[model samples]
Target: MSSRESILPTEADFADFRKQCLSSDNWANKYDKHGRQVWVEVHPGKKKNQVPKVHKIKCKMVIDDVPAATMYDVLHDSIFRKTWDSAMNESFDIAKLSNNADVGYYSWRCPPPIKNRDVVTLRSWQVKDDEYIIINFSVKHPKHPPNKLNVRAISLLTGYYIKPTGANSCVFIYLSQADPMGSLPKWVINKASQVLAPRVMSRVHSAGRSYSEWKQQNNPEYKPWLYPEQSKLPMMNPAELSIQKADELEQVDETFKVDAQECEDSS
Candidate 1:
């Protein structure tokens, strides 16, 4: 029921996410739509490492009909993700590191002229009191190498926090500071927080509304995320994954099509 002591995403990581979620200090409000709001903050890259400037994004909404637990399930269900995540090109669990942690792969479609992107991440989840936290960061996996099909992106920190508000209502917050590895236009970066973030949030909200019905007919009792004992995934050694660095990946400018084959090859 318990995992090995200490992991890549320590409790401090979760605490920092929670803190940021609750505060709006430096985050600039981008837009607000039907109670769902988005904010963006640009942080300069460190001088020594030459890290790329990070765009910290926050999107939050309140749903009166969907429970927090159901939202948690909606986010974790890869099978269900196929039905809801329209932009997703590929996604799957690679290996399990613990009952509450794992490494996974995800690739998504980007708008025309922009090359598609993918990432391998060390993901972990936890349930504490009335809140549920799911967080992940980019990690290099030896067994799964980035192919030419998609530029390897880096998720410095990305995750969700869900908290119950009422019997059937909850607050859902998403926070991300990821670098889509490639030379991208300023407009593209602006669109991410302005247009893309809200669209993704809307999709998730809709997914939560209908997830309960879909789960009942499917494997209703199977929830590896909540009940890790039910996971059939093979155990993986934590030593195999290292924190992914942006400098290591090839920086291809996405303004021009990297490969036409990537679009055709996508399933």
Candidate 2:
């Protein structure tokens, strides 16, 4: 059966379904987790001519050996991000650094057949100490309207707190609070969080573990206090990478060419 012929609900029917789904008392329950509960609290503020939604998300992870300061470096390193962050498809160096902290920009392209659209974000990272770091990110979506969506700026605040658990092990706590734009039904957003949050968090934790292992294997004398220069790595230029397959095909020759003498001999 054709995909278009498959079971499909009309706009009104889907709207009714979403309305029923969002009305549930557990609509807010989508933010909860087991052992680690991250709450999403929507603020009661709105512009006179616009609808605004403010929410927060908090979660935690644990890492071994690597201190929070070094982790901050790892987080800012656009090249290292692909290792764990599935949401971010491409990143580039926007500017060179003068100190431990650097300003950089990243572009996110969701994994596809979804027709992944790109969103640009500016990030700032600051290390409080060997045990704490803070990251502030702002996502820019030119396609989104500024008035109706509270997440127009896509401002995200994240903090990482590291503490020693053992001689070679440490506990990593991650907290993120952000507003994602779109006129999506609250229930649909909640449902997506229920299904994908755990998997995403697991990926992040695994990323930390992998980085810790890499640090041990390579920098046995690794000092948690030092800001590593591991950020320098070749990244795809977005302009060149953004070309569509059709454009690439246009550059190729269509005619098939073969040596006439060789063809005749073979025949």
Candidate 3:
């Protein structure tokens, strides 16, 4: 893989991906609950010994009484994430690549016997007319390599699209095309298709509800994403990053017996 600044996600890349997220032609509706709907587009891996299937998931919900800007802040507030993102094991900013983009490290828990997962991603954001978008895709960062504790996952494309409906409400959309680098069991796949999106959206909505108050008590005026001049993260050279491919990482077995209790708890 070429280690060049050009490898990072760009304005055109974000624009094209945003179009895909907004489009509905190829997406197959999968799950819907509590006003949230999820659609999945399954793409079989091109070659052998790669991930068998890559899932492009799109989920959306109308969040009432929450402004699009507030929901945007919720996604960027790492400190606030720690409190509500129970599945998260560890996360932090690695370096700033630009005013609208950065490289970061994130790891989260998987149900027992599935092992944990981690990723280094190049994240970017933009505010279009009536919309707020934040996106991230996996990247290999030299300073942070894969560890034995968590399987390195590949996030092909993942982000949020928030469009204001009114002053106090917005339509929240989450889109992701990711490969969890492991031998996924049939049951795991089934559970993911059925509940992952709704569960996550619920958590996000819950977080958004309380974020304004949380921000006030915390660093009320500190928003590095909106005002990059305030960021304390060291600037980074994009030449150090490359695409993180699933075949380059060690594959772990995510197939194990999970009881009803464990399944319920994970969701």
Candidate 4:
């Protein structure tokens, strides 16, 4: 069957996300990572409009010898996330909104001294000809709420545009705007947010290149939510998660041991 025939998003849904995926604005501060061009721009807020800081990021890179479908798989597949995204703590669909839309939960591992942040998002994805677009925004759901351990961060907008460049490669574009809902000033937050996206985008390119091989070993049978014809899969189990607090605890111990060794050697 054809890929367009195999995916499930509606024409209206595809149109909406495609618009956002391709929407362009003047972006500044361009740099390079992993042989890909990366840049970030902060939209200055006007208090009269009630807008806080908005961080706009863009990254472009070509993954050699990987089909666009495989890159799409890397971006949308939840089961194979842990293989490339080291910061992702947990992620899964909360409910199927439609054949092509769903609510998702994602939690990330933050460095020490700052608690982890999580978000609930509504996602829509579709493949048109050789181009694929997946876009999402933060939302609130009753079943999932702010927990004691992790703070909830609002994702104003997050999107991806994947277009085939050749028989074996594609260009990946990522855009993100988020509000952590903290006491930090808008300028302070925007600057801090700028540092995160480039790192995330760099990791994404590395992951996209390895996706095909990773999926083959991890869970080749797993079908994505975009593929409605496939059988339904359950949400990830809390116990089934590969990265847990135990792993964080081990890292803490390792740091402590290193500190003790440093003192002993110095004395």
Candidate 5:
């Protein structure tokens, strides 16, 4: 822990995190469907010089009887995460950078012929004005290098914004921008943003509500502490995962930028 504690994230990290949190709130209010407040949008990210071959996923949801804290716990609880997030092949903390910061490893299972992708990230969170913010960006860790088993990806931007609206109710916005290394067909990215994001978010909301009960029954002793672990994630090839309609597939127009602020103009 001391070795991990020695290194620290810069002020730039916190600055970006705050900007994202505020942006989330702004977007949540900006995007509406038929006068409805909750909105979700998934689009192909602009091929910025910074991050190429990326997708931008965003969502807003209000869960009944679930507080912001509960949602945070359900997500950060590493042991519980394994049960819900279908894409997560393996996830565990690598080190404690500080009380509010850490290094974590996350691997996702990809449809075959395409190797699974993983990343090592420095994560941090904060609670202010009853709004919770979680942010993580990829980093290079000495002990955790690119493994032979998985393609290493870079998480350019990944975060969650949870703001309380009422008792036991909160607004959630999730955003992700990542480059999953290897040649992932544009159709795969398109379908992921168009199809999978909504479906996965629905699962998250359901799981967030059921998590506490599931925890009590299963891993009651589970400590959500930030301790390090080297997980050897078994690669289980599920049958249903595949890219459909290769002939009809088309690439996202990389020249077009999908800015959140500009999303209101999207039909």
Candidate 6:
């Protein structure tokens, strides 16, 4: 084997990587920091000799709400997760329930544009009447394996911390760790996380805010259906048919007018 020197990623490189990861822009070059080696790999794919690995992502938010139980309920409740958690598109019913707390087996489907589907079995434990909650989840990739292009593991663990900030306020913290699986390159993992993690976290925060507002307005006691409605997102309007047709007609008229002018000039 030929001897080779490792390349380190510079600040500029990291900045450029961040920009690309966040916006899907192009990067001129890629480098590795710790390995201290430079390779000519210039795409989003797995690395050589890199096995599927797990990574942890943590997020925290402060919401205006009291009653630790309510905060925990909003965050840990399976029905509520469908509303706020960006990773979860839709949820299924839990067949088995433990008597001690709200424990059951649930599965989730990934959002659009991704071909893979994930099925998760999770359980939640409420600590001291919702003061805090311990959530454990394991993910299984039914479609892909560790060696595939989209290598994903079959297990993950997530925890939630909810504490009362004031009489009418609370703070929420979430931590998730999972293996991406396969031989994914480190740069790809970092890039994907750097880009998507923050956005997803932001969505979760926004969802929390919306949920809190809805709860305050409709107080579950007065309206039991409030939760369901809060979870349902409003559909976007379709493209305006009349406007498109009008634009097409304008284009046709302009073309004919130009042709007539050309003919008159020629004559």
Q: Local error of candidate 4 at 119, Å?
A: 0.4
Clashing pairs in 5: none
Candidate 3: where are CA atoms >4 Å away?
A: 1-5, 42-52, 190-193, 258-267
Candidate 3 lDDT over 123-160, as tens digits, reads: 99999787798888899999899999988878878888
lDDT of 2 by residue, 18-105 (tens): 2332233322434445434344434345454453333334444445645544555455444446766756644555432333333334
> Per-residue lDDT for 1-267 in model 5, tens only?
123323344456556665654554333233344212333332335355553345455656666678877787776787777777777777877756555666778888765445667777777777667777787666666567777777666665677888877788888777666555455554455335544544555777878888878878975655443232322333222121111212222222233323222111000
Q: How displaced is residue 261 in candidate 3, in Å?
A: 10
Higher-scoring candidate on lDDT, 3 or 6: 3
Please give the clash total of every predicted structure, in order: 0, 0, 0, 0, 0, 6
TM-score of each: 0.88, 0.51, 0.89, 0.73, 0.67, 0.47
**Candidate 6 per-residue C-alpha lDDT over 1-267 given as tens digits, one digit per residue, 9 for 90 to 100:** 012221122334334322322232222223223212111223345574553343444444556634545656565445556655645434553322232222223323332222232333334344554356555444222221122222123334555566676776776655554433323343444455434544544555555556656656644444212233343332211110011111111111111111111110000
Ranking by TM-score: 3, 1, 4, 5, 2, 6
Pairs with backbone N, CA or C atoms under 3 Å apart (clashes), candidate 2:
none
Q: What is the lDDT of residue 190 in candidate 4?
A: 62
**Clashing residue pairs found in predicted model 4:** none
Error of 3 at 203 (Å): 0.6
Residue by residue across 1-267, what tens digits does model 4's lDDT show? Answer: 023432234577567656654555545656666656656654555454654345655656656667777778878777777676777778877766655667778887655445566777777777778888887766556567668666666665677888988888777777666655433344555655555555666676677777777768876777755567673744332222211111122111112111111110000
Q: After superposition, how far is residue 242 of candidate 6 from its true place, in Å?
A: 57
Deviation from native of the Cα of residue 114 in model 6, angstroms: 4.7
What TM-score would candidate 4 get against the native? 0.73
Would you give me the overall lDDT of model 6?
0.38
In angstroms, how far off is 84's CA in candidate 1? 0.8
